[model samples]
Target: MIGDLLLAWISEAGNGTIADFRARAAWLARTENLDLHESATGRWLRDASALGHCEVDWKHGKWSVAPPVITRLPLADGLAVLVGARRQRLLRAIDEEGVYAEQARRLGSSRDIPPPCTILMPYERTRDLEEYAAALGAVYSGCAAAAIAALLGTTAPAKPTAPPAYDSPFEHLSSFSPQTWAPTLPSRPNPSEGLHREQVNGRWQHLLRREGGWYATDLSRGVFAELARRGETVIRWRPDGDHRTRTGTVIVDWGASLPPLQARALVLCSGFVPRFGSAAETSLYDNVPREIAARVASSLGQTLQTSS
Candidate 1:
């Protein structure tokens, strides 16, 4: 039960440091009779990390976990993960394949018909039907579940909720060029106007929210126009107009509910040198010319623009 609680916490938090887990465990112990200590939590994390259930940073004491991706496997391999009444049901499904063959044929190519193992793998990996479908490349659509349903002769699961336009606070920042003026924008809003403006040096300089954070801008109409042209929602202040008020605030909404990028992107974007065990294994960014990185960055910008 403690192990289950730990996994649940990791799933909800996405990532956390050892201290974070320890504190959370303590709280759970007090409120929920979860009686796990810091040492127990640490041991469980280490074991899970060793088993490839999660990634860990020993030095910094941070760990992260993602839902497992679906991989092709045979029945023997599949049964190693499935159990209980579901296991018996899967056996029945596979045994009755001949009965469903005609039904499966009407759905699509017989060759594309997923096995009982395919249906069971999702159940073994996660209880989240959407995550299961997504791992099988169905995304929010019910296509993956439909395939499994055709095989099992059951109704397909409902389609997942549509993802939001922007998911992360960092996403809007990543849209701009890494080295450009846009990437330097400030995230801290001005207390008085609730805008990205601050008194810097001796002048009241305007700041824009960009790639990494807030950056100083000239506050030119042209700059606002350019940002708007780039598909950013720019709320301009009108002191004496209908949109004006001392209490008016600018709200920046991060859209699109996509999952955060994995550690590889975090490492590369932060300029970290990743170490691999074998000399033969090399980082993708290693020995690559700066031009390649720049080209990739430009392509990302283009993709964001197109999506917007």
Candidate 2:
């Protein structure tokens, strides 16, 4: 009873993984009390394999191997190999003269891996299906798949095909050149405005949010420190007007969104000697030290005076 249920499940599934087969076995065991032991199931498969299979004949003397044959019937010129009620037709276009006859071709395999339950017959038996199936228990298999592969070369293994040369959509990006400019941070803001954070010499500070604008507070500090080094006490820092006020993560949330290059442009246009601390510090540009920068900050502070 378990074997019958197991065979039915295998037939229904067509092909399934070992896990799926085990699950089905457990379910059958629980529901029907029919325990299909894995070992028993394996033995049944082996027995089926020995009993018979199917085959196809590509051409006379040139046959296509099929599965183990359960039955073979001689047709007009060619033959038909049947395994478990499934029939494979092999063509033979030759006459009764036995001279060079027409060739025959087998249909493609019905399944991808054809389930371990089913085996693919070799090409030879299809020419004379009955004799070949009878000789199954006569020979053990050898390991020369390459020769078999050559015969089954209808679908060769895929090789890396040379890709056609095509231009990338962003190929023009290579033409873009990065602009370079000096940086100048303001020391004080028009007597009414001051740095958001204390100006520390030779150090990058925090980020700043002012007037609904996001500024790299570190860049501002570095600029101020550079100004101090040059004895430029009177300085003006102008945050870029084109930026979101929320402080965003450097590389992740908002790296490209911030106009670091535009900030450098503003500083360069302002005509102040720009200073830089190091390469790492200079990479982040967000504000310019200009006359309006100080004046605007000062005006804002006066309008909304903060005692802190």
Candidate 3:
């Protein structure tokens, strides 16, 4: 089932990095209120590649659907792979008695069943086969309706919709503040001045607007100092662990707001903030606010001069 979803997304997206796939998967989870785990997307991508349904470019770190001729897998081989993957999960679940107990109850077996660990005791792997089969059948039926919808094209890629117009850019920022990180303004005569001092005293920051909202990261913290300095509501995101070196590469949940025009500008001018140890920064999208765009261009020019 996951394999089918992966193929369909890859086909529609043409080609993308694992990060791109994960981003889209995150969006789907938010919009559809489904339990589409990001880790599962990466796992299924590898599975698809292994099954010859997709091709991976190791050097470029991109994936695309394989040629039709090489995409077919023998039914028995495919089933073997599915069973092997699922069996591992079942083995892990055997250690959690609550899982089997829930399944047993769902399968209409109210009588006290053997503990999950005991169900697969040494040399008795098939002792509870009937109970396991019933549990699996129940799960299958629960997802059958959604699976049919997915197969029938109801789960197509979302179309980019127009963002609503705002009287001021600040209003636009506020509209997405709930999903993205917005700075808490100080109660001062000139909040911008106070915010500027705070940001400059901190480490450099990076920002990117993708899908529909902004994602910001700072070397020392996950704040959008520059945007905050401008009284702009910038969303904040922190990496899972010590991932400061690859801050720009992290994927985050930015909600279901699809402000395409602003998102496109951010994508086109993604280099506005230089990466660590790199002297690259520029604004390529002209539609961005003039003052911010000018500063980005000026910063890039200064960097070029210093490097020269």
User: Which candidate gets the maximum lDDT versus the true structure?
Assistant: 1
Better of 2 and 3 by lDDT: 3
The CA lDDT at 120 in model 3 is: 14
Which window of ten consecutive residues has the lowest lDDT sum in model 1? Answer: 99-108
Model 2 agreement with the true structure over 1-308: per-residue lDDT tens digits: 44434544444444445445546556655675544444543333332232222121111112122232223221112323223322221111112222232222222122111112222233344444434434432222221111121232111112222221122111011110121222223322221121232223432233232333324333323233222323433222323333432111111011111122222122222111122323333322122223323322222221111111
Cα TM-score per model: 0.27, 0.19, 0.23
Q: Candidate 1's residue-wise lDDT over 68-153, tens digit each? A: 32222122222112211122333354345421111110111121211111123323432343443333332222222112222321
Q: Flag clash pairs in model 3.
A: 180-235, 181-234, 181-235, 181-236
Say what the RMSD of model 1 is: 20.8
TM-score of candidate 3 relative to the true fold: 0.23
| lDDT values for all models | 0.32, 0.27, 0.30
**Each model's RMSD to truth, in Å?**
20.8, 33.6, 20.8
